[model samples]
Target: MAIVSEALTVEELYYNYPDGTAALRGLSFKLMPGESVALAGPNGSGKSTLLLHLNGLLRPSRGRIAVGGKPLDAAHQAFARRYVGLVFQNPEDQLFMPTVGEDVAFGPQNLGLAGEKLRERVRSVLDQVGLEPARFLERQSFNLSIGEKKRVALAGVLAMEPEVLVLDEPSAGLDPRSRRRLIRLLKDLPQTQLVATHDLDLALEICSRTLIVEQGRLVAEGPSEQILSDRVLLETHGLELPLCLMGRPDR
Candidate 1:
């Protein structure tokens, strides 16, 4: 097979749980470098399941995934993990370290960074996510507000310096202000981002393209403006027009 030259590629991907539940079925797509795309689908559409497959967290029952042009398998799992940093839907799931600095530094530290290099990575990523390292570092990770925890969780992923960032339900539980902050932060990031979300507005705001998945299949893929504004197509797959698109003539 000719190698795919995209930042990320998924070809005819399929996955099944031990109980025989098929989470993904023949899904294929390509994500280019520095491109922001959204995986928009309703519950049980295999959005999270698909993200896990990207970095080899959950093995595919059948099919293939490649990161930075290399096939993802046990031999390349390490590279895939580092190349595609996944921020889970819940901030608590990713922030287990005692202090904010410790949690932020965890990934790079595992990769052998220490002392000033380690501290710098932690600080830079925190700042990258709009958190002030000096004031927030020594603070307890568990004590942070929901918004702060979300930013800290993202900082940890950014610290890995992944070529592609895959986030699941990034705006799931945020207040309007916090969600707005996250939207702005995500828009400014430079990595190839695949955000699996129910927030079509976020997709419409930050993504160039949108992939609509249903029953683990790629039902539709197109430019965000075209795909997201199509009220019929979105509703057909258990989604709605982006909030901003509502009340328009098309609606």
Candidate 2:
């Protein structure tokens, strides 16, 4: 039987900013193929800083990271970027191209896709993200609503066909309907996912496992239902029980 490699791994990771502020401290975790995991923490708990290291956007000050079992070093960083798709909390950081189509095409275009192949890639991912390609293709990206822009940003990442998806605060700044739509879309995607979010309900709905980080270190981990239902555990980490569990007798 062929062995399956882990989709992502981090070992003894540490990162400190130029100002000497420590962002990550000996943090470590792993994601197997097709696993959906949630990273829960309070503000300044280093979730964003840790995520930037996944694709080599921010190199770790110490320790190791691997994408699809390949070391994320100077040589493999490019591969890591292509293998791991990261969606920022803010759509503005991602949607910078003139039109929606151009923004979505940026990654694959850089990968050497052109003409019909590139067009199809853009069209396919837009459809994946629930956007109508014909209507969105030529529209100026700056004109889309918050929900549309977030989906467009996700489409841009999806066009790369990455093996893993890393999203930071994916549900932030969304209306209830838009949030539901985004949740549905994420549930349908097949990539291994590491979602950093404060939305416990979304975490329970989408992620099978949950890891809690505190003061730049992993403090707890377990099945989503088991971990998310612990009121004391949630409160200790500056989180609350999932809304779905709020009224339960045990909650």
Candidate 3:
């Protein structure tokens, strides 16, 4: 039998800013293929910093990161992005194109796809995000609501057809209905997922495994149900248990 290659691997990663402020301290973890994992932590717990490393947006000051068993290096960064797609928490940061279709087409266009291929790619990703091609294609991105913008931003990344999807606080600033729809969409995707979020309920619903970080260190890592149920653990890391799980006996 063949062994399953890890989708992502980070070993003893350490990152420090120019001011000498350490953001990641010896952080290490592994994510398997087709797995959905949660990165749960308070603000400034290195969640965002760690995510930057996943797609080579930020280089590690020390240690190593491998995507599909290949080590991440300056030359290989572009290649890595082909397999690892990252979406920021704020849709506004990603949507600068005049039209929604243009934004979704950006990544593939950069990869040398054009004309009929590019149009089809844009149409397909819009459909994937629950946006009709004809209606949303020509729509001005800036005029859309926050929920619509988020979906459009996601469609842009999804068009890249990555093997692993890394999302930072995906459920942030979303309405209940939008949040539920986002959750359903994420659950349906076949790509390996690593989501950084403070929303315990979102983590519980979408991720099977949970890794908690605090003060740039991994505080806990385990099954989502096991980790989230421990009130003391959550409080220790400046987090609160989800209200829905608050009175449940299992929790």
lDDT against the true structure, each candidate: 0.91, 0.93, 0.91
Cα deviation of 28 in candidate 2 (Å)? 0.7
After superposition, which runs of candidate 3 have C-alpha atoms over 4 Å from their true positions? 249-251
RMSD of candidate 2 to the true fold? Answer: 1.4
Cand. 1 TM to true fold: 0.93
- Give candidate 2's error at residue 119 in angstroms: 1.6
Give each model a TM-score. 0.93, 0.95, 0.94
Off by over 4 Å in 2: none
The better-scoring model by lDDT among 2 and 3 is 2
Q: Give the Cα error of residue 144 in candidate 3, in Å.
A: 2.8
User: Which candidate should be chosen as best, given TM-score against the real structure?
Assistant: 2
Q: After superposition, how far is residue 109 of candidate 3 from its true place, in Å?
A: 2.2
Q: How many clashes in candidate 3?
A: 0
- Of the candidates numbered 1 and 2, which has the greater TM-score value? 2
